[model samples]
Target: MKIGVLALQGAVAEHIRMLGLAGAEGVVIKRTEQLEELDGLIIPGGESTTIGKLMRTYGFIEAIREFSARRKPVFGTCAGMILVAKELSGQEEAHLGLMDIRVARNAFGRQRESFETDLAVKGMENTVRAVFIRAPLIESVGGNVDVLSVYQDQIVAARQEHLLAASFHPELTDDYGFHSYFLDMVRQYR
Candidate 1:
């Protein structure tokens, strides 16, 4: 199946590479019109505010909401998680607000504090390597949200129906477990 990575910003190439490893065609989505051609979409990590601003400027906010309403799978990493959240701690505005979650932006501290870890994600047979860079933390989740993986007792990965979110960058690592899992999600939805 074809999976589209939101190309407004962030690690587009890395995610595309991961998607390739996961056995799916990865397409870069620069315009809202491109959303219609994908089976699933991945929103990669970047500066949350800047991504949100760009989404608004490009008229993607409502388009993405519509996309999610169709029950297609959506995966968000780091800043992308913040964008998908229904509420952002300390911030009055929400971006896409498609996932029923609340997040705290850069809760892992600055870039210098970034680190890597192996996480035993739910539904995975092996631990997955994750890279956290200025990551956000899931403060809370709605009843529909399923906790996937946690680190240091903090919510770092979760899934809500067609929506999947992670506080770390799975694409940055060599592991294809997360991408494979996302591909499964897409397959189920397709």
Candidate 2:
């Protein structure tokens, strides 16, 4: 499967490496047309507002929104998670509002406050090491969304239909299980 990593900012190369290590062709998505060739897509962690703005500048926001509406699989991590939330309590006007979840940006504090933890994700056979950096905490989730993982009593990862949002960066870890699992979702949909 061909997986595209949003290259506007963040850990794009890391995700590409992870996808390549998973035995899939990975592409760094820059132009809007790149979205068409993707079987799946991963939105990497970075400044949410900047990435969102760049997506708009490059016209990728509309493309991604349209693709996602068609049931395409999209996984977002960290600030990417913030971009995909349906609502952000304090910054409603800034969020992309893709997934049906309410998020609180910088809920875990600043970069100096970043941390790592083991997440007990449902269906993940082993404990996944999650890297949280300026993470957004899931405040609430709509009924259709499944709570996948949690950290310190806050919802860190969730899935609402084809959209998967995680407040932590799984690509930073050595494990590729999460990436593989996401690809499996793409395979199921494709």
Candidate 3:
């Protein structure tokens, strides 16, 4: 299976490497036209506002909405989770708004507060290592959204149909469980 990583900004190479471990071909998607050729997409962790602005500048916002409307899987990590949320705490606008969730940006404090931990993600046999770097917190979820995992009582991982979101960077760790789970989502959609 081929998966495209939104290469607008963030840890593009790290995500690609994780996808490789998950047994999928990971392609960097720099243009909206590239969205048509993927089974799934990964929006990696980065600066949320900057990523949103760049996506808008490059005309990727609508293109991605159309892509997700096709029922293909879309996985968002950290800043990506913020982008996929329908609403962001203390903010008026949302980026993609593909998932039915509300997020709080930088909820885990600043960059120096970033840390790592293991999480028990649903449908996985083992705990997945998670890296939080200025990650956003999923403050609330819609009825359709399934809570996957939580860290310190905070909603961190969730899935809404074909969309999967995580407040931590799974790609930063060596474990490929999250990526594999996402591939399974793509397979089911296909």
Candidate 4:
């Protein structure tokens, strides 16, 4: 399967590397046209405001939403989670608004509060390593959403149909469990 890492900002190469390690051909998606050849897409960590602005400026907002409307899988990490959410705490609009969840931006605090840990993701046989860096948290999820992992009693990972979201940077660690899991989602949907 060919998966894409949104290249507008943050963690693009790292995500592509992890996807490659997971046995999927990964591409850097700098334009909406690249979405045509991809079975799935990953929006990596970055500043939510900047990502949102770029997505709008580059015309990815509607394009990605249309892609997801077709049931193509999309995985969001860190600020990406904030972008994919339908609602954001104290925020006016969402970037993609494809996932049926509410997110709280930077709910995990600042740079000094960043940490790494292993997460017991639902449906996966073992734990996956996660790196949280000024990450957002899922404050609430709609009925269709499933909470996949949690940390310190806070929701960190979730899935809603073809959409997957994580509050941490899954590509920072050697564990490709999350990437592998997303490929499975793509295969299933494809």
Question: Per-model C-alpha lDDT, please?
Answer: 0.95, 0.88, 0.95, 0.94
Which one wins by lDDT: 2 or 3? 3
Residue pairs in steric clash, candidate 3? Answer: none
Q: What is the C-alpha RMSD of each candidate to the true structure, in Å?
A: 0.6, 1.0, 0.6, 0.6
lDDT of 1 by residue, 1-190 (tens): 9899999899999999999999999999999999999999999999989999999999999999999999999999999999999999988989999999999988999999999999999999999999999999998999999999999999999999999999999999899899999999988888
| Model 4 global lDDT (CA atoms, 0 to 1) | 0.94
- The regions of model 1 sitting more than 4 angstroms off are none
Model 1, position 136: C-alpha lDDT score: 94
Q: lDDT tens string, model 3, 56-92?
A: 9999999999999999899999999999999999989
* Cand. 3 Cα-lDDT: 0.95
| TM-score versus the correct structure, for each prediction | 0.99, 0.97, 0.99, 0.99
Q: What 10-residue stretch in candidate 2 is worst by lDDT? A: 89-98
TM-score of 1: 0.99
Pitting candidate 1 against candidate 2, the one with the higher TM-score is 1
